[model samples]
Target chain A: MRTAVKKQYKVAVLAGDGIGPEVMAEAEKVLQVVADKFQFGLTLTPALVGGAAIDASGEPLPAATLALCQQSDAILFGSVGGPKWTGLAPDKQPERGSLLPLRKTFDLFCNLRPGQIYPAFAELSPLHPRVSSQGMDVLCVRELTGGIYFGEKGRTDTDAFDTQRYSVAEIERIARVAFDAASKRSNKVTSIDKANVLQTSILWRETVERVAKDYPGVTLEHMYIDNAAMQLIRSPQQFDVLLCDNLFGDILSDEIAAIAGSLGLLPSASLNGNGFGLYEPAGGSAPDIAGKGIANPIAQILSAALMLRYSFGEEDAARAIEQAVQQCLAQHIVTRDINPNSTYGTAAVGAAIVATLRQENR
Target chain B: MRTAVKKQYKVAVLAGDGIGPEVMAEAEKVLQVVADKFQFGLTLTPALVGGAAIDASGEPLPAATLALCQQSDAILFGSVGGPKWTGLAPDKQPERGSLLPLRKTFDLFCNLRPGQIYPAFAELSPLHPRVSSQGMDVLCVRELTGGIYFGEKGRTDTDAFDTQRYSVAEIERIARVAFDAASKRSNKVTSIDKANVLQTSILWRETVERVAKDYPGVTLEHMYIDNAAMQLIRSPQQFDVLLCDNLFGDILSDEIAAIAGSLGLLPSASLNGNGFGLYEPAGGSAPDIAGKGIANPIAQILSAALMLRYSFGEEDAARAIEQAVQQCLAQHIVTRDINPNSTYGTAAVGAAIVATLRQENR
Candidate 1:
């Protein structure tokens, strides 16, 4: 008999504020079950962050926590900020102090937000039944660090101006992220830009087209930003992955989230070039539901799955976790957030997902 | 006995290409009925434009047509461009040649697009029945001459840039248009911008606030572009007049049009500082449906109604024409576009609206 060595991975776990810790506890339970079933070795290092860190060290992101993250493979982030930290200076606020600085330190540039309408939860969508019945599963790959938001801006006595600048290197990197993501999902990527009028968009389209050549199996198409906005609402089933610059992404991603039904079920990941990422729920910490034991844990659990797939390249483990979640939702073993009348609590929901994961064979 | 002199108005009618002629004839019939009922003197001068002008004089906007437009109080434009004109040079293409030049020559800086969903046609909306049941009526007031679209743009060896520049005068003028439009409708205006990130948007918000003081009866609110996009889908009934710069408007207006059911029911207006305006349908000229007599004429008829309200300031006549079209749609006397299986043609739909207008006591 030959001795087998399991693949080992390290992640910095920062369950930030309010309901963060409660939901994160459930996520941990589910993650542990997934690791055991997939035969992977996991090392989760817990750290203080957000309001909790502010109380301990008078800083939202303590130096010790930053050092821990620097040594880890990825960061599994929970929802941050609460009323307790509202009095702090804007820069010292939990969100701005932690996430923004972490992104800068790691050079995290690509943001992936997956908006889906599961057939079981299709009724949650705001679209007419006729449209929502077709279902939607769109992944928005947005360039996070560049574009007009980070470009030069100034104001004269009577006029104000902002520049939207993009280099070929910047466009190429983001395009690759989108294409790579599409190859993993539906094999189709729609690059969105305003090519007809803006010089930057013209360059963006050209660069994206060049990058598409590398991913031979992925189908690539181009869409104007305005048309993309309408198409998302008119026919969301037609899209699999949407590649966009910062400004357009900021608008379209929110639209995608809105049409995806409940915000509590959405997960987001901001990744650096080296595959390291900060994964979190695309929602805020609800202080009111902190210890209620009924907060939904699906988003937090999904974030862990994203960390597994993007940072660890454990696609099997990630898909298993996702399918487990779907099974729980299908069985109505959900928290109050997803179903107000449901009797299941956060722990029960996570336990249900874990039980489903254990039964699903690879 | 004192003789009452009817207010005389001269309009240059440019029924351009494809289904433009057929639709314009129906629009003219409705306009005539409304004018007779409202007691107004009207002079409509027929002129060639788009592919028609290109064939007649090898120019999409012939010099004679420009002269005719300059002599009139307003321009009633039908759809422009078709396959026949696609062979022309990029600049000489029907739409690029005619509308672009006309907008530039007249300095038409304000664009108004009203998107509405009547209770009878509520089933046409893409929103869930629970959300669309409330109905929607939003007017998008867009600044056409400023913003990133027309701002300075250039490309370097590795980078490309586009500037989003706005002056106090530019913001103030568009702000006034929204406020004035709100005063006539719901007495509410929602100005959309990205003030948190862009200097131009900050100036835009400040200028709009200062302009709000001029209209005390109208309520004003500011929203980020991203949030505006989401809110439009989540709760469209909350909005009335949407004030936006060129880029944001381009996206939101298309979104509004998409949610309003059919493109054949939407109308647009472009106005200069002097009140001279150009009114047209938002949909394109359906070359395939041309000369079939089955094309929808509601949009063209509504364009004539917009001309009466905005340029001629014949509010009563405009309201009567709008109500007549609604009554016709409610009765299901619509063309193939609105109801494909219906046997009604362009002439029948226009005649129904004309009869409805004559019967309605305005």
Candidate 2:
């Protein structure tokens, strides 16, 4: 008798603090079910991070946790930071210490923020009836580790300055990420910048254009940042992928996420030049609702699904988890954040998605 | 018979191109009536600028026009540029050549964008039902002359850089402008910058704090640009005045204007430290709607009101003009953009406001 071998992969899971563990547990359970259904071997190595790690080891990003992530194929990150870590030094805070260092260590230069909305949840959208009626699904591909944020900045006797610097290589890589994302979706990308004023933006536009040659199947358009912000509010559905630098991306991504109505339901992925990635919820750790059993777990679960797709290269499994989450919403199985009257707890919503996957397995 | 001495003022009107002449004619008519009623002497100087200037002369911002503006007390500018000038070089284009040079010439360091929404038209807002129910009325005080826009920019072999520089004096002036604005309104000013990340922002926050002392009546708060964007969409009415650097202002002002439903309904004023300034419709010259007689003249009419309020110090006259414009909108005496099925045209809307003012005068 011949037996099929399971494709094995090691996953590092950091269930940070507050609602992190609760949400992370549900995501893990869903991922386990997906793996079982897909015949893939997946082992989750749980570790300390954020305020939890700080309390346990007096540091947000523990050396042991870093080693675990270094050895793993992918990272499934939970929300970090809470009131407990508020007094910590700027760089030592749960968010800054763990997340920032992780991105730097992993060379996670590109962050993909997808503002996707299901048809059933469109009513929750903040847009006008006519604008939301069309629906919005825009992905903001941001160059996370560069631009003004990471530039050399200081104050002189009379003047203060921050250098917004970008190289052709940096722009090329980020542009490729956007183009690649566009190729998978609507095959259209809008490179957003202030090229009329910023020299970095001029280089960004030129590099993005040069990178577009490699993506012949993808259509490219450049838009000024101001007009992009207005257009995003006016007709969000018109944008497929918004390729932007750090500052513009920071603003546009938040704008797009807010437009989606439910920030707790959005999943984000940070990627390096290689296929390796770290996936997490776009929202922060809800310390106020910690251990309440009512915290929204959809973002965490979807993040796990993203981990499977982007890092594990298990696209079918990712889609199955995504569809399961969407189906749960259709069935009105959600947490309080998504629906104030929702009866389902975090565990219930996770179980519902797992059950959906189990049904597909049969 | 003792007669109040007529206060004399010269307003340079640059009816550049497209519907510039059409809408400007209305603004001038309303201003003339206001001057007559308010017992003031006002003279208008029609000068050439933009593509129209290029048509009459060899340059966009003709020397004669600059001299005219220099001689005038204030500038009441109409819209500029059209398809006819699209083929011109980047610097020679009407928008770049004329508008930009005018800004530099006058040191128009502060741009005021008031996103005031009348309760009667809140249905046009794109925000969620709950968000727009309160209505929005926020003024964005943008530092127009400095920051990354006017900073040094250069390109190396593979990299491009733009230096975002801000002097103490620059930040102080803009901050004072914001605090002064808040004094007249809700007495709350939110200074937006990326202080946690950028050096310039640190200077900005400090300067704004120092300036807050000068206006003890104003409540000052600092917020990140990203959070500011979210808060604008989530609860715009909470903000009384938004103080920001050039780059953030460019993005946020447009965003705030978009939130108000229509750009064509917004008025803008660019001012120097002196009372001298230029008032223009925030919306672009719609070459498409040039001679249609269906273009919205409300913005231009409102621009004239802003000129009265900011440049000429005619508060009652400005309020009267504003009330008349609002009354026109309420009465459905609006152009095609505001109300498609309405029978009113550009001339009708302007004529309606003038008639309302005449009735008020009687």
Candidate 3:
């Protein structure tokens, strides 16, 4: 019998603009440390994206960058779009060029947002004790690549219109994703929609019901989007996997992050047909705090870990990085965002995680 | 000089099935006491609706009820919909006949929901001390009758769609309502939408901007629905009038109620083209708790107060009823929902509020 050789994991890193570069640098450092500790053969290929690419090569996302992404096992994306690139036409905007292209290219169907409130950072949550005490940890699996966001748009002399459309295939595919995710976690999935009002939602609910037959092991429930919004605040712990459309997911995911405590510490992954996923921080590019050297890097670093597990199949490496992050927080080594009294800079906080990882390896 | 004849306010009261009858009775008692105290000439006309009508006349909302509502100065509606009537088809469902038709007949364009935290009920909030200390109060002004809810809907063999349609005129009208409301209350309005992704939202924002030019005194801000949802939980009091489309409003208003402490305490008003408005509790008919006298009547009573102010223009009567309810709560004479320890039944709570109004008059 011939010994099988494991494939090397290739990651396409898009460090876009502003704090993106800073955070990406820290995430890369953490990944390298994890790679060494776990003996995983990892290769990171840098690609120009967003305003940085537009500045250097006259395009926000060059054809070459897409080629690099196609070859890579996973893509780790930093934030895109800044005021400097806003003057560009709608299609050429940094966000449209890089973010939309990547999603479309890979047909990234599912957006997995894990809103976990770390035990160490529970105090940072703004929710009342009763609301937050239950430990708000939920994975929102949103159908990203379809729905109204990708619908047809046009303008006439009298009126402009955008179609809010969905297909049964789209709903079915996303429903399966949510059901599969629910099976892995708490075995409960709350499908959110406006079925009572929208024909699209009624179809969505029916399709979800049909797909749910394939996953009898997982519990399924339906909630109107409005009630879901209230329930998120009233008792977040009651939910497990929240499956919703792209638009509702975008709003609800952010809401979930706010409830979890801090937007600064959440990571997300967008995956599609090719097993290639784009991992990024749930937080936006904070232009106000861009050059302060004080932006929290945990979300970015964790995105790198997600890339390791989902894109590269390096579960051990991902677990090690996650543990190091937890250890750093446990030991009271945190950034200014989570611990205001802390005097640590972003680099210092990133270094602490690296140091913890080194010690754990020893 | 001839003295102007004082207008006599006429109210059409629809006391639907279950605890609707109980709450509506209390609301009527409170209204009568307020009318007497304020020396406002008022007449209350009872109308049959919902399951009660289904039993008596085999119709959910009889023609006589519609005529009575059309003649009244305002409609004071108790909760509708119950399991007993769920077997009916979509058109005959109590919600469609009593609720939808009422909205259509009134042409109620604006639905105003004020979520206030009563000091007596602060202990009932699930938030921790630090989070709930400031208390949360929000008034969500939702455009009641438009957006995707009323848009054209159809399904093909493979696809389904709902038009997220809004005209500039519609958006402008709703925006003016929000600005006017904000001027009266906290002088701040946060317009919520998905402007970044939806063309409908883009139009919505543009129309609001144009309308806002007229209301310079009111502070204006625009937030994506996602961020607004987060902000609602993070710092709810930061909002005054949260203006959004019918769809977003429906969801956000419910969320606002949840954050304010209890769904049982929120009231809403839906107004139409003819200046005729229907006032109702935000809480739906709880079929499970239908026959029990435990359903909170505060929301229902407050809805009647809204009916007086908005429809009848009986501001003094409205204020009197509001003050009585507040005094009752301040004195801890609340219902079972707000005060489980209290021995007060639905009728007793209503009587207490009526007594409070009479005492204030004395």
Clashing residue pairs in all predictions, respectively, total 0, 0, 8
What is the lDDT, from 0 to 100, of the residue A204 in candidate 2?
A: 90
Error of 2 at B177 (Å): 1.7
List DockQ, one per candidate, in order. 0.91, 0.84, 0.68
After superposition on all C-alphas, the RMSD of every candidate to the true structure, in Å, is 1.2, 1.5, 2.7
For candidate 1, write residues A1-362 as lDDT tens digits: 98799998888999999889998998888888888988898889999999999999989899999999999999999988888889989889999999999999999999999999888888788888889999999999999999999999999868999999999999999999999999999999999999999999999988998999999999999999999989998999999999999999999999999898888889999999999999999988999889899889999999999899888999999999999988888888888777788999988988888889888864
Instruction: Name every residue pair that clashes in candidate 2.
Output: none
Order the candidate numbers by lDDT, best to worst.
Answer: 1, 2, 3
lDDT of 2 at B199: 96
Residues A1-362, model 3: lDDT tens digits? 97546557888999888788788888989988887787767798899999889999999889999999988888998888788888899889888888887888889998989897677777777766656667777989898877777788654433456677999998988888788768756899899999988889999899888888999998889999988988887888899999999888988998888888876788999987556899999877776678788888999999998888666767778878888888888887887888889887788889999988898888
Cα TM-score of candidate 2: 0.98
**After superposition, candidate 2 runs with Cα above 4 Å error:** A1-4, B1-3
Q: Which candidate should be chosen as best, given TM-score against the real structure?
A: 1
At residue A20, what lDDT does model 1 achieve? 95
Tens digit of per-residue lDDT, candidate 1, span B134-201:
99999999999999999999998689999999999999999998999899899999999999999999
lDDT of 2 by residue, A100-150 (tens): 899989999999998976788887777876788888989999999889998
Docking class of 3: medium
Candidate 3 stretches greater than 4 Å from native: A1-4, A81-93, A155-160, A287-293, A355-362, B1-4, B127-131, B287-293
Q: How does candidate 3 score on lDDT?
A: 0.83
Can you list the residue pairs that collide in candidate 1?
A: none
Winning model by lDDT: 1
